[model samples]
Structure formats: structure tokens, C-alpha cells
Target: MENNKNIIPEKSGSKYDLLLKIEDIIKKEYSNTEGIVISKDGEMIYEKYFGESNENQKTHIASVTKSILSILIGIAIDKGFMEDENQKVMDFFKEYDFIDKNEIRDKITIKDLLTMTVPYTFEEYMEPLEDFTRSEDWIRYALESIDGNGEKGKFKYSTMSAHLLSAILTKASGMSAKEFANKYLFKPMDMEEINHNDTKEFSFDTLFGEKIEGWANDPMGISAGGFGLKLSTRDMAKIGELYLNNGEYKGKRIVSEEWIDKTLKENQNGYGYMWYLIYNAPIRMYCALGDGGNMICVIPDLNTVIAMTSSFMMNAKDRIGFVAEYILPALSN
Candidate 1:
């Protein structure tokens, strides 16, 4: 691939040099890694792909799909498919009879689900698939699977909450979450090489020697909003660029800037919608984090964005700290 020269700064500073070194280190340290670092303005400052980019080489991206789900919700709001964050989730499910008649479920708002505070215990409901054939009816399974716990607005990290958000978006848009994402989010960004892996069967070794199939086999299947997205490293960077640019791309305003701001602003768990806010450092950065260390880190202060994908989901907190400790500080110096 040809490099874009104009995007490269004329006077490369020590930060640039340090980033190069870090890139080299990462390639040597990690196996099957694809990473890119871009300036806030959408310039690729650094890029490296170590393993492969073929069909079977796709990165599962785990929870990073949550960020894409977040954008779809924002688009739904912008298009009037959804009224606002406070809109009742039950309102969107007019045709679905599986939803409980309990007032608590009706009272659960889009905001509650987005923030993972749906006032329900999601753990008992979060069992792995017993077999590939059992992985049908993901939505009903998720809804009925919930173990009633706390009141709405309480803090808890529940995968089922995100699953419900995906279901709501699907109901409102009259399309699956993947379809909506392709039309509204990916297409506008020129991200054509993306795929949603909600339905493929694979197995991984669990801690206790139990063989577990990929979570994609859950009854909710691929539409599980919290995870199950797959994309190229460059495309992932483009997502960060969209958020960094406040929902605009190449003079096109894809989503309202107000929605972008609202999505990044801190909420429960320092989480805005499906995104996370990290204000602990000298700089405030909002990021989309996934399992296996897949991340799109957006540093508004430095006008920078970093996207990383690795085979092993490990040490994301430390990696983010590394950016704060080395990457940005070197850039500023």
C-alpha cells in the first residue's frame, strides 16, 4: 500500500520517532497483530500488520462492536427512528410478545440499556451455548434469560443490556443491527470491507478445561450488541475518526454533533452510551475497548487516534497507560 505523504508531518519530532520504536516493539512482542496510529485529523502516522489479513484471519473485536452499536443508536436518534435516550425500550417492541409485561421492563429506557444499568442480573442468564444447534432465538433468550436484580439506573456491566439495545435498534430501523450499521454507519465512512460475525461456530479453551464455542453462538446470535463485530484495522481507525470529528466525514455531517458530544460525555461507569471515558490521566480520552485488546483510543486534546488489534486480548489498561506514559508525552515534547 502506498503511504500518504501529505499526512506525514515535515519535521518528525521525538514523539514520532518514539512511536516508530514502539510499533517495532509491538510487532516483535505480539503475534498476529495489526495496529495503526492516526492523528486526530485522520492521518495515518503509523501502521503495521504482522500476521495476516485473509479470510480466516479476521479479528473477533469482542466488545469493540459496542462502539459501533453506540453510533447506530446515535444515527437512529438523528433519523427520528428513536425519540431520545429516555425513550422507553418497550415502545419499540410493539410486535414482540416475548417481552415481559412487568412495569420494570417497560420502565427500562434506551439510556438504561446503553449504560449497562438495566436493573437486572445478567450473570445467571449469561450461560455459554450448550451446542451449535441451540443458538437460535437470541433476542427472546436474552430477554427471558434475565434474572431480576436491582432497580433501573443502578450500575452493572451486563452483556444482555447491550443485546437489548441491539434488539431495540433493529426494531426501530426495521433491519438487523448489522444491516443498519452497514447502511447508516459503514457505508458513509467508506468502510466496505467490514463483516459482522454473529453466526459462525468455533471453540476456545475455558479456564477449567471446558471447551466453549465462540460466544457468537449465543441464542441472541450475532446481534448481541456488546460484541461480535469484525473489521480491518484501518476501518476501525476510521470509526475513531468519525467520533473524533464529531460525526462528520469529508464535509458530510453524518450525525448531529450534539449527539456525538452526548455520547462521549461521562455517564454511569464513566461510560457514554457504549463508549468509555478516561479522565484519570493528564489528558481526557474516550475509547472503544474490546476483548483481546482491540481498541480505538481517541485523544481529543492531542488531536490523535490510535487503533490496535491483537490475537491475544491482554493488558489494555496497561497499553492505554503506555500511551499516556510514552506516546502522547513524546508527541508534545
Candidate 2:
């Protein structure tokens, strides 16, 4: 998108051939793929659209939104909106009376939310999405539904836990996660030009001119940090680029390198914060993996970022392996 044809192609080599092969796999192996975008050293070297999707068309990124929220949490801490990663989450939502408040729940910290290890026993216990729309307070519902008996610091993929992080971001930053992200993360990365409606401060109710800016909110108007964020293939590449540069995008420091460093260390399940780590041979990949095969993979040692979006839901492991199985071996030794 944005007339990116000017991106000079890399030299014709094995890696370039391997880059081209990714599309064939997407088409033959994964028919649901929308597209794949790859960049190296900050320049988009390969991009191809499949089906009806274009380079700029946006779609729901599902759990990939969690990785973006993770970045914003690092920024919130850097800006002092949040005290630190260890801050107790209950401190932010003191207004709510949890149904099963216990020692474990009180010890739930920001880091726990970032790592998906919040001490809650309701793994598959969210009120139905249809029911969420009718509820007056999502955070209250989330807090009340928890059993508070989960093992602390253990990894459990919980969207409600992520929702708590979103609420904390809203309470600490005095704005919705969408507004705070646009102000700090997206706007700085030149999404203003990508969307052309970033001049005015977007109200929490709407952002990017209310024109499908790819954000979903709860009944209480807080952006869902765990899922339902929409971003184009191009926008996803920009986010990977930011992490590739260690929290600095295009020479401007957005979040601290300390935060990036902390994110690289595995917390659980080869996951650091919200980012998942997948080992692909000699390369250790840091990935923002979403339901339905949506992914933004960063190979720090290789200085490469690969992003892909697909229609299938909850199928990311095989897609990630494709990159390792094919792309990683093609690079020169």
C-alpha cells in the first residue's frame, strides 16, 4: 500500500526465491490466506495479495491485537501512565467488588496480564459475545466471574485476563487503549498518513474518523485489548518493524529498549509478555500470532519481519512452521 512499488527488490538469491515460495504455499497449502508481507532492514521486499484482499484492506486481527496491547503497556509504563509491570492490577479497578477475592487475585500483577498468567480459574468461562453487548460493565463481569484459585504465574490463555489489562490501561492512562495507542504507537509510526484522519484527538467512542479504523470496544467503550482489532497487512508490518528496531520506529523512540529486552526473555510457553516465541532452527522467532493464522513474525538475528493474514480460525502453528521449514533454510550461511 501507499505506492510501495518503489521498494527496490533484493538481489536475486536463494532467499529471494524462498520469499517468493511463501505465496505458493499460501495458495496451495493454505487457501484461506489473504496475503503475506515480508520486510528486511526496514524495507518491504515482498508482498502479494490473494483472493479479494489488497495490500491496504483491513480485517479483524483476532489475538494479534494482544501483541499491540503489549506494546502499548510498555509505552504506558515508559510514560508513567502505569507505575511498572509489577503493579497490582486490582489497584486500578478498586471500584469493582470481585466475587472471589483471595490472596492469589490480590497478587495478580500487570506482568501477569502481559504474560497471560493472571490468577483466575475461568479459562473458558467468558459470557457469550452476544451477551457481552447487553452487559453494562465488562470489567465487573470479568472480575465477578473469576474463581481466584488459579496457580499464580502459570500461563493460561485468557481473553478476559487481557480485558482486565485493557481496563487497567484505560484507568491508568485516562483514555481508551485505542486512543492511547493512536497517540503513542500508531500516530508515531505514520498511521496518520496511512489513515489521513489523525489530526484531531479521537474520542474514545470513535477513532480514525469512525471509518473502520479496526478497533472493537466493549459495552463500556474500552477497546478490547485481547481481540477484535483490525489492521491491514501493511500496518502489521509497521508494528513488526518497530520491534525489529527495538521499540524505535523510523528513528523516533516509542518505547524503551529495556521493555523490549524484557519481552525477549521467556516468561512461559516460550512467550515473553504477549509475544510468542517459536523456534525455527537457528532462528528464534518472536511472533504476534493470532487466531485464524494471522501472524507478525520478527526474526531479530535475521533482521526480517514476515506478516500474513488468513481466513481460517485458530490455525497458527502450521503457518509459523512454514516459515521455518522453508524460509529459514534459504538464508545464506
Find the candidate with the highest TM-score and give its number: 2
TM-score of decoy 1: 0.82
What's model 2's lDDT at 277? 80
Question: What's the lDDT for candidate 1?
Answer: 0.67
* Model 2 spans > 4 angstroms off: 1-10, 99-101, 123-135, 192-213, 312-317
Question: lDDT by residue for model 1 over 1-333, one digit each (tens)?
Answer: 322222344658676677666655554454435555556555676666654443223466767877888888889999999889899876876656854456677677888877777765444345443332244665655555544545767676666677778888877888777778778877888877344444444334321112322224344444657765666677778888888888898778888899888888776478887888887877889888876668889888788888776555455345576677767765676
**Model 1 Cα displacement at 139 (Å)?**
1.9
Residues 85-184, candidate 2, lDDT per residue (tens digit)?
9998789878766555477777778898888766554544443544443457768766655556667776767777778888899999898888888899
The true-versus-predicted C-alpha distance at residue 284 of model 2, in Å, is 1.0
Count of residue pairs whose backbone atoms collide, per candidate: 5, 3
- Cα deviation in Å at residue 151, candidate 1? 2.7
